[model samples]
Target: MTPPEHGILGRVAGAVTGKVVDAVPVEEILEHVDLDAVLDQVDVNHLLDRIDVNRFLDRVDLDRLLARADVNALLAGVDLEDLVQRAGIPDVVASTTGDLLGRTLDVARRQVVGLDAVVTGLVDRLLRRRGPAPLGPVLLVGER
Candidate 1:
């Protein structure tokens, strides 16, 4: 039978083999490899299709993931004014402003009506009209 491998000789042989293997650089091995052929063999679409999206999402810690993200940096990359304009925010603001102005004008008109009564009373008092003074109609200053 052939000599049985063990002890000091076996250990030395193993060490020498390991050192020789280690001496062979990975870059030298990669240089000999056909990278395009290796890439062609990989089915990326098939691998992705095998992934369960819901299960993957369930495994994800969304809040923790979001906490790690730089929100201010992300926002800095975005044009907020442009985004608001695209979302029709300006139109909404304009419509809301118009509604508010219309309501304010209506309120002013009501207040002016009360002022008309007060001014008419003052005018009647100046004219020295006796008995119950009639609250006259609103007279526009520039109207015919």
Candidate 2:
């Protein structure tokens, strides 16, 4: 039969339901229930499909996550030698140093050549010898 609709019986049923609900111990009822059994009846994939992932992620606290990280200990765990080897830093440094040493030697060689030229000019002036500073170990007719 249909439930009572808007009459003395409906009012009386409402009053009785309210009293019964008030008298019931909801906490005790919950304690008697098996949560695993309830969960087994749930459709997890359907629940996941209904969830808004981006909205859920927006509620995450990123600062609190970073605060839990140990940065100093993380750095201490790194292998610097392995890192340098992987990056080929030693080869780069060796090539750069080799180029620097070569340039330095070239500069020193040029300076020594300039000093030799100056000494040759001075000797030619003193001996009254002219003809292009005696030209590489070959003596002129006026000298031995």
CA RMSD of all predictions: 9.5, 6.8
Cα TM-score per model: 0.49, 0.51
lDDT tens readout by residue for model 2, 50-99: 99999999999999999999999898989999999999999999999999
Point to the candidate with the largest TM-score. Answer: 2
Model 2: colliding residue pairs: none
Error of 1 at 37 (Å): 10
In candidate 1, what are the lDDT values of residues 1-144, reduced to their tens digit? 224667778778888768966998879878888999999999999999999999999999999999999989989989999999999999999999999999999999999988987887898799988776553433733332
- lDDT at position 16, candidate 1: 79
Worst window of 10 by summed lDDT in candidate 2 = 135-144
